[model samples]
Target chain A: MVEPLVELKGVSKSFGSKKILDNVDLKIYPGDALGVIGPSGTGKSTILRIIAGLLKPDAGEVYIQGQKRQGTIEEGEPSLGVGMVFQQSALFDSLTVDENIGFALYRYSKLPPKKIRELVERKLEIVGLPGTGDLYPAELSGGMRKKVSLARAIITDPNNPDNAPCMILYDEPTAGLDPIASTRIENLIHDLLFKQGLCRAYAIVTHQASTIRLTTERIIFIYQGKIQWDGKREEAYVSTHPLLKQFFSGSIEGPIP
Target chain B: MNRILSSSGLWSWIQRSWAAILLSGKAIFFLITRKLDFSSSLEQMMAVGPASLLIALVTASVIGMIFTIQVAREFLQLGAGSAVGGILAIALARELCPVMMAVVVAGRVGSAFAAEIGTMKVTEQIDALYMLNTDPIEYLVIPRLVACCIMVPALSILALFTGLTGGLIVAQMYGIADTVYLDSIYNFLDVWDILSGPIKGVVFGALIAIIGCSWGLTTRGGAKGVGQSTTAAVVTSLLAIFVSDLFLSWLMFQGLGQGATMIGQ
Candidate 1:
């Protein structure tokens, strides 16, 4: 059996009386690019936050590489070795592109400044942004900012130094991009994950159907705080379940309410 | 119904502001732990401090001239215009110099810090920091706090000297040449007056930094939220300085009185 890179058992979350996630049980195998699809506010992002240990579940256990990770986030420490790219390109406007990417390696690295600069350059080059370090977030176009943010996320590439159960938790990575940009981003996602091959895993939270088709091998659809369907991505659209039909149908009135 | 709704809406806004402050306090405490970009902090200080010098100089000069004019006018009419030097020293040392300098900084640079940080926060860059295993406070708060602390006092000292110089020119212009202006001014402006204001400045810098950074970290609701926090930081820090000024003034006065009275007794 392939080692589960991440596991959630009976996880539940609520904001006031509104339940966001309900008994979410999931497992991501090593190197699997799992796509989580759902309508807005269906707790897709909440699950990502849970897996990254950013938000604690009201009940249930969360395991990263099968080790429980919780309580540390509330205390201002992210225990899971998960990197996240938020729905919005959350790059720091104040810091230049080089500084932004360099943040990940600023600590916990013994490399000298000259060496670190080389490493940072390599990370940017991998993202197709070569020799544009001094530029601020404001200078970049939307798609460019998203790519810079992606470069920042994989700055360390845990597989490079240690196989640390690394997972890139992408939140709407291609949501705001144009079709061409979206396709490019989607391809990058697959290429990066393929590079992970049998070493790193990935989880994406998004609403775009095309993004779902291109990258994710496995799929889970969330609705009303629970998993409505879980299977291969190709099977999701054809699933006869009422929830999947209503969601994929883009109906105004669906099983969601 | 309208009146009730308006009152409730006002009440929640106030409540939300208070909660944001409290929540940001915890975040600030976490942020000051050395997680922020050190190079950025150094660069920020260099940027903010060097740029503010001209403003401080202008403010100091104007305040000095005004103090000298007021004192010299009153003294000239009373045949005590010879004491213009003493009057300027008393005014600049006791109250005007440090207070004015710090207020200017709080208004100009402090607001800038709050707006910059608040916008970054609303955009989710700080969330990115967490994802990267970097503590936002260490990365964001410390450098800013350190910069403000160093810059406020440095500017205050510059303000003090330039302010005294401004008074000297005014005194010389008014022909209050009988008394030794420089010597008298120096004598009247005591150690307490000089020391107390800077001490207040150190405290004021801390207040400005905490309020600004806290507001930034706790900002929500997007761009409008950033604007709101920036405005709140400037308003609150200035208000804090003024309100605390009363107590600080009283403490300095009372402390001086006791020391003088003891000597007389």
Candidate 2:
């Protein structure tokens, strides 16, 4: 078995008196595409935040490449590279699309501005958003903004190969989009993760069944702060886990509510 | 019973403000120990400095003219017309330019910082910065802090000169002789007096930046929160300026005894 690149062991989180996550364990191996499916506010995004070190788990440990995650930016870099595609795109409104895509490069790479722009254009092309370098986020449609945001996350730091993100976390990779736009995004994710062969592992938190079917090989169903079901994508449809069936069937009358 | 109820609210507010101050201090400390983002700082300077130049100049000019109109007429009637220039210079340098310019900036630049950062906070842009391995304090707050510290002092100096020009114009129209007006300012305006306003400006600038950014970082509850933070930031910055001004004025001028020695007769 390939060594797990990222792991969450006995993880838990709470806000005020409400528990958000409880004793959750998860693992992602090299080259794995995992789908985390759940009802809204069921700690899917929270899990991604913990893995990225943006938020600390109230209990339990997060490990990257079998090493314990370190706290604080001053600590040496973690063993695994992590990138996040935010649900809202979250592209800096003040920056142009190219500037947004090239931000990490500009901040952390030694590449000249000309080279950065060239690389940004390349990423834009990869996302099927060619010639959008000059446009701002506000000028772009919702779908375009989402694609540009993904480009920003996955744009490699050519100068520092070490900074290249291998683990990508997609929060709602296709939300608030027309079906055609969502298909485009789903194709882009497929191309980036498998066709281009850039990423090692990915976890997508999304409601779209097609997105899960097309992008992920493994899936986990989370409900009420616990992993209620875990299995391969093939098993998702056949497994008669009532909650999973309810979710997959889009049926209102089931064990889910 | 009323005191008990209000004290809890007051105490929580104090704790919140204290946390913000501590965060600002940490951001400032990061300035000393880390590589400063000069590009961002320069951008903020352009926003808080030259961009604010027109309004600061206009406000100073109006205040200077008003001071001269009110005082020059009365002083000339009393045979102390020459004293009008010195008094205007003193008041503008010691108090008017710094306080008034700070008020303008608190309204404009400070509110802007709070609004921008507050929106960023609520929209998860700040969280995105963190996910990018960018420290918000280092990337955001320090640049604004450094920009305000540099720009506000520079603006205060410009405001001082503009105010003097306004006073000179008003004095000429009020029939005070140029020689009398110029001579009085030359004789009475000590280097120490002139230095005081810009010095105060540096302090005021830091207060505005810290308070604005702090309130912004502390913002919650979404769009409504951003609005509330912007209003509170401006109000807090203004109050801070006035209260600090009293202490700064007393400390800078105490035991200086008119500061006449700095300008030999």
Q: Clashing residue pairs, candidate 1?
A: B31-B137, B31-B138, B35-B138, B35-B139, B36-B138, B36-B139
Rate residue B78 of model 1 by lDDT: 70
lDDT (10s digit) by residue, model 2, range A96-132: 9988899877887889999999999999999999998
Off by over 4 Å in 1: A72-74, A157-160, A163-165, A196-199, B1-38, B255-265
DockQ of each: 0.61, 0.43
- lDDT score at residue A186, model 1, on the 0-100 scale: 86
lDDT string for model 2 (B61-106, tens) is: 9999999999888877877787888888899988999999899999
lDDT, model 2: 0.87
lDDT of 1: 0.77
Task: Give the top-scoring candidate (TM-score).
Answer: 2
Count clashes in each candidate, considering only residues at least 3 apart in sequence or on different chains. Answer: 6, 0
Residue B129 of model 1 has an lDDT of 73
